[model samples]
Target: MTIFDKFDQLAAARQALEENCGDFFNMVVDDIISATEAVVNGRRMILAGSNNYLGLSFDSDCIEAACEATRQAGTGTTGSRMANGTFSGHVALEKELAQFFKRRHAIVFSTGYIANLAMLSTLVGPDEIILLDADCHASIYDGCRLGKAEIIRFRHNDINDLEKRLKRLAKRNTNILVVVEGLYSMLGDRAPLSDIAAVKRKYGAYLLVDEAHSLGVLGENGRGLAEEAGVEDEADFIVGTFSKSLGAIGGFCVSNHQQLDLVRYASRPYVFTASSSPGVIASTRKALSILHTRPELRRRLWDNANMLYQKLQDLGFSLGPEPSPIVAVRQQDKEEALAIWNALVQHGVYVNLVLPPATPDGGALLRCSMSAGHTAEQIEHIGQAFAAAHRTDQAAQTG
Candidate 1:
């Protein structure tokens, strides 16, 4: 094929998708009121798709910090972090993150994506390898490519698969860095960290846990999967995002490995990208403080999780392997999923629509990510909306 043929093929397929299932995917929102709800098409919607687990997006402290930062620091950082973008706020935020994770050091990035890119690329190289979970977020995959490492994949959360890959890696005389997500974003299932940690130790490989989804949603202190599994010390790297729990924009990496400071200089993702603005840093710092002190917030978050899990299962909708904040309602295909998604929005609810190949199975998924801010009334309304959409789809098919 010609060099441009791949682009032509992708353009054609995307056009087909637009033609057949455009409305559901290309929705426009009028206003977002809170973490759990928004106004779209002049109608109020229950926002079950947002990653704002702690629902601190609208916190007064964060907003005020952002406003103040806007006044003081202006709109953007303008230069790369290696040059002039590294602000005092960035340094303070990294220190806060390190303290939060109880690690020796931390580095902040412009985004959770860049955090993965920086860590994986800096940690793995020509003489090192990267092993990632099959269901990990796309950033981890990109990080492997950036590192130019020998990329290996294990079955999603399968300890046996991880062991198999690690065993193979041991024979190669190369350094191994195995990466996994705290929670699989699409499916909303967490990794078996304890088992994975054991296997990594057995094979003498380093482990990196991307706590993007679980940062403020798991653990007693919300330190994420490793803390919950009691294997925090075993993980060589812990990556997280401020977008979810901290209710801001930025990414961080914390580690007890004394060499983390080296990545600040060696990793292009950290050095080249503009550092997070003061507003984001300030807001995230405040949010982190609240999250640390407020254990009740975590309880409320899990309460929402349990309610959604139970209600979705009671509705006869197929769920993921286990219950967590993110819930996936299985659908037949993209067309059916789009139809259901459209029906739900028309009935006043919003959720993420997952289809092949973003979804592993050929089926589509109506993904719901709950937040602590979601009210009981809102949750009830969402359940009713799901039932309504489910009924309408069945009726349409029957007709």
Candidate 2:
């Protein structure tokens, strides 16, 4: 067969998406939009899927700081962190991360995905073992693939299943890296941190919690799920991204072990990649300060989450396991899932679409994310749009 044969799946997928793309209400917003109501195609569409949990992307302070940094340091780093890429702003951001996590050692990477890739790939060699949550982000899976470690998976949020794997690892390897997420992105449910922590203790495997979705949204000071579950100090390593609640671009790994600093020298992704620009560091600094001082943001985020989740459920739509920053509606089938998604877009509502292999356990979902700035009325509007889409799908199917 010619090499072009490999393009079948990719081509088909693109065609399907393109055909339905025009019907979508939610998409990458090119304009500087503030508040939930914005003119898209001259229609006021409710923004729901943006990862800006704190709505800091539009915050004046963050935008001004970025502008100032651009004037002072220029637009790009012009080099990688390993060479001329490292700047004073980068050092300050690293320090802020260390202090925030209360760990002596912290390393910042270009992106959250690269942070996991660099550290996990560099830290684990041929002699190590890596056990991960089944629902972990693709970065974790990719990082493990880059390393020489044997990858093992445990059931999603099932501590009993994790304990079984850890026990088996203990019997063979003395060193193992156990990975789990603070909050799963697709399902919007949390892991059993306390139970997983106990398992880590019994087996003596190092635990690394990915707080990409939970940071600045969980715990008293927005430390993350580990802190909320009281396993912060006990965790061997904690990794997170600045993309979501942090309102910036970058990733961090904080550990009391101090050995994480060594990964700095060995990680290929870190050594080869360009460092984050001055603006990212500056804006991230401001966002972190707000996260630490303002507990009200977390409350507002959850309040919006609960309001939307309850509204969806009351509309007779099956929801995810719990009320989380993410809300996924159970679609009866793939066509219904796509139809409901397109209808929601037509109604000026944007959310993530997940189906089959994309979702866990071959299930399909219409994933919606909540932000702190979202209001009660806006959330109800989302539920209503989905309900209307559901009815539309049902009517079409019955006909």
Candidate 3:
């Protein structure tokens, strides 16, 4: 058999999707009108799938910072941080991130995925163990695979399951790292950080919380779920991405442990990958400042999220467990989900159409992520679009 034969199943699935839904997966934005609006397929559509939580992408200060940095520092770093890429702006952003997270040290990476790869693959060695949530991000799983450590997965957000696994490994006399996410991306459900932290402490294990989706969306100071749950001290390391809330491109690992500063030397991903562009670093710094100075952004974000979530629930849609920035409507049938996604687009709303096996469960999700930039009227419009889309799908099925 040819090597290409292995991809036959995937190719068949893609063909089916395209035939059914008109290629929604590859739909491109023709133009970005704002943080909450975009032109897709020559149609003005409300953006409800983008993870711009604080909605600083269109902020004048951020845009200006990016332009100024590009003008001054050129377009790209073109080298790894170990070589010629350690710019002044990069150092400054690291210090600011450490200060913002109240950590003693921080390390920046080219992307959030690499940040996980560097930490997870390097921190725990062959004799060590990594106990992670079953529903953790793909990056976390990939990082684990790159490492030599024995990986164990507990049920998602199940404190009892975590404790049981930790207890079984207690007598192994090896280091154990417990990894969890502050906010799960798919279902938008939150981890029981307080409970997980307590179990980690009881098991004498280290804790790592990936706040990729929770930064600037949780805590009074936007320090994420660890801070909101009052377990920051219990968490040994916190990793997050700027692509989400910071409205730029980069990833970081911040901790009280000074050893994190040395990961740059050993991490292959950090050593080999080119550094982020000067403009991205500058815009990220400006966005972080905005996140710190403007608490109202978080409030407005929650207001919009709550409104959309309530509207969907009122319409008898099966939604995620709780309402936050991410509001996902679960659908059991993939064909119906695709029809609804296309109908929503036709109604001038664009959302993420997540199908299995990517979904947390073996179901489809029409995922909507709220932004502070979304007006109340825009949120109402999104809800109406969903309602209309559902009706159209049902009518098609019945007809």
Candidate 4:
């Protein structure tokens, strides 16, 4: 028997998709013009799928910084930080992140997934317990599995469920860690951090907020949902990524707790993985500066999101919980989702087509993420494309 025989079910599913949907897995972007425009399959398309929130990917300053860093520090860091990967840039970036978040310590990781993995896995032990949100990102779930802590899940965004679980655990003397996200990526909904923080405080549990999707998109200075919800002081750790708002590749965890710096010694993911490249660090630093200095970018992003969301809703399409940067259209089924997705692409638009198991509650999603770089005209064009696609789907159904 083949060792890979267990993946036959998945392989068959892929084959069926490709046969029916014209190679959905093999999408290739021929060129990227900007944060909101790209060339795919030899056609220029409006990009509504990329999560480049602040749209600093094409900023002149960030590009210049990345190029200069590549020239000075070479291409990559060849080893893990625990070995030889700790460069001056890495140290400087960590310090800057600590200052930016007003935290006592900050630790950088190769990627956001690794950041969550390192922090979640290393913070708790067998004697402790982890309370997780059911709808958290996969990285959080993996981190929970890597750790020795007993894991428990509460309903997604249900503060009452969380408090009930905390009350039940009140009699136990075990340490507790509560994990949640600042902004849930799939739904583009902000967490009720104030309420969650209260529950954590009542239970005397550590609260960790993963701000991967919310950083640079919330709060007065774009710190995240914790800051927006006025619960930053209550959160034990604020974890985020540079890839989204910062428009680069890296991740960081900041905390008021001085002991957070010690996670480097315990986290296998951080200890074993190679550090982020100097170019990434440089670009990210520049992006961070731009993110702070340019509040107009956030305003534009929200405006674009609101416009498109209103248009889609007016066209009779069901959307995610609220109007944020991310706008997802929940479909009747996988077939309907794929049909609309393909139609949009055919009409010179590109959005994410998320399938079952990957989507929440086994639903299919045509996810659209807005960038600050998107112009008002581009947003209107996208709305038209979506409306047209929906009309096409309706006509096909009736015919």
Candidate 5:
């Protein structure tokens, strides 16, 4: 009887969770003190869930840049980029990003999601096919849908599976677009870009890598997994977000192809959505500079990630394969996952509580993302809290 009838399953599931946990999805951090800590429910908690990898959100330079731009340009951009919203900062940032990636073109979007939507949807024609990783972010899937392209999903991080699909399309004359993430948000595992790139080359397909999670967390210059994996030349397009490593809110696509500029006119997301605010663009530019100048931040970020990952694994906690900034602790069921997540919060530690369907394997996850701002002591305390939370959950189940 209603347009929302399709959400019956979602509504029932949410209703069940609300009955058990009283709105766990609507958690609020009353005060965020820094990149690594926040105040929740009158208690200060270490923040392990936020994706502020380089912890540049509170950087003095970035804050100053944002303030200065805000003072000059006022608040929001009232029109889309195609209209009156194009500012000098926006254009400058795009040029800087293109230079940073050594690409011929760079186009900014309102968000990382929009970046994917703009590029994936606009770049492919109706005659093209999209070969995407099954575990790709929702934005990528949505973009493919928007383009109405024939979407074929390969197994997660399975290069062999991708090759199998590519081989099947060997005789097709349609354009092939293979999309994968630099670092998957859930498990933090990276795609085998070198092998995947080879497969793409064999099939004459274009490769696009989303570096949303990996930016500022990998590579010597923080260009992401493409640089670290030595496949920058192989990847035809790179999509990134200022929200993750740059600690601002925006998305971008960079490519050496001269034709990338044409997407600016063709992409609806880019043409319709209002461009990023001046303050955001300014701060992102400054943050990008910081990311390139201070490689030490990346080192600290990895140190924090390694410490937490090793300690959690030693405690017999099931974690995602491979050690990266993202560390997801798997739970046996939804109930246990919620219990442990609640216990962790009660112990003054905040991490993401991922439930079924949203999670990668139809299970629950205690997902933790590391930040360079987290001190050694703080990381140790987080490990201890996880141990205590696990013990508390186990005791409750046995009792």
Candidate 6:
């Protein structure tokens, strides 16, 4: 058989998805009206799936900054940062990121995924050990694979499991890097950072927290979970994405350790990948400033999140563990999940449809991410849409 034969199982799964839901995986957005509204397949839908948490994507200042930067610089940075890609904006943003996080050093990357790739793969070597949460993002796993490190997974958010694994490797006499996320994307549950940090300290392991989904969404200064938990100093590294709350495209790793600056020279992902464009850098910088100054945005985001979460729970839908920006409605049956997802679109709402293996519990999820841009009325309308979609799905099954 050819190498292509290996994809038969995946092809079958995709075919099944197409037959049931008209290719939800590839569903296109015909037009984007705002951060919280879009026209998809000729239907205007509330954008509950997009991870625009702070809703700065459409902010006038951010947009103007992007436009001005694009006009000043070119459309794209044609080279990697190691080469000719390091612009004034890039350097400024890195410094700002470090200052905002109150860290000694910061390294910017092409994307959030690559930031994880660069940091995780480069920090730990074959002789070293990486003890990560079982539910860490795929980027962390891929980074582990890219490196030759001995990877060990502890149970998701289980401090005891993490401690046990750390104890087992205590005598190895090699550097151990502990990796986790500030806010888990799937279930919206938070890592017990304080507990994890305590365990890390006991084991003498370096801690890396991916704050990709938590930046600008948590903590008093919007620094993420580590800051909220009062353990920011314990986290040796903090990796995050600008695509989420910052409303731009890029990733970064900031740390109090001055040695972090060396990752720029060693990380293949950083050395090979082209740097973020001028517009992205400019918009992200503006967004960061706004996130720092406007705490009301964070409050509004939480308000909307709590409202929608309570409404969904009131509707008797199974949901994630906590009420963060991410409100994942869990479903045991994949077919039922697909039906509900389609019903949602029919009711003029768009949400993310996550299926098995990708999902934390090997179930399906109709995931909704809240944004500060969404109005109270919009949140209510979304709840009504879910209710109507559920009713439609139930009627279909009975008929």
Quantify all predictions' global Cα lDDT against the true fold. 0.87, 0.85, 0.94, 0.91, 0.92, 0.95
Clashes of each: 0, 1, 0, 0, 0, 0
CA lDDT, candidate 6, residue 367? 93
Q: How do the predictions measure up, each by TM-score?
A: 0.96, 0.96, 0.99, 0.99, 0.98, 0.99
Q: Between prediction 2 and prediction 3, which has the larger lDDT?
A: 3
Off by over 4 Å in 4: none
- Which ranking of candidates, highest lDDT first? 6, 3, 5, 4, 1, 2
- Give lDDT tens digits, candidate 5, residues 1-399: 899999999999899887766638777789989989988877899999999999999999999999999999989889899999999999999999998988889999999999999998889878789999999999999999888688999999998999999999877888999999999999999999899988898889999999999988888889999999999988999999999889999999999999988999999999999999999999999999998889999999999999999999999999999999999999869988888888888889989998878888998999999999999999999999999998997898789
> Judged by lDDT against the true structure, how good is candidate 3?
0.94
After superposing candidate 3, which stretches have Cα over 4 Å from the reference? none
**Which lDDT tens digits does candidate 3 get at residues 112-202?**
9999999999998899999999999999999999989999999999999999999999999789999999999999999999999998999
Using TM-score as the yardstick, the better of models 2 and 6 is: 6
**Model 6 agreement with the true structure over 39-136: per-residue lDDT tens digits:** 89988999998999999999999999999999999899999999999999999999999999999899889899999999988999989999999999
**Residue range 327-372, candidate 2, lDDT tens digits:** 9887757777888888887877878788778788676889988999
Summed over model 4, clashes come to 0
Candidate 4: tens digits of C-alpha lDDT, residues 160-257: 99999999998888899999999898988888889999989988999999999999999888999998999999999999999999999889999989
TM-score of 3: 0.99
Error of 1 at 368 (Å): 0.5
List the RMSD of every prediction in angstroms: 1.7, 1.8, 0.7, 0.9, 1.1, 0.8
Alpha-carbon shift of residue 239 in model 2 (angstroms): 0.7
Of candidate 3, the 10-residue stretch with the lowest lDDT total is 20-29
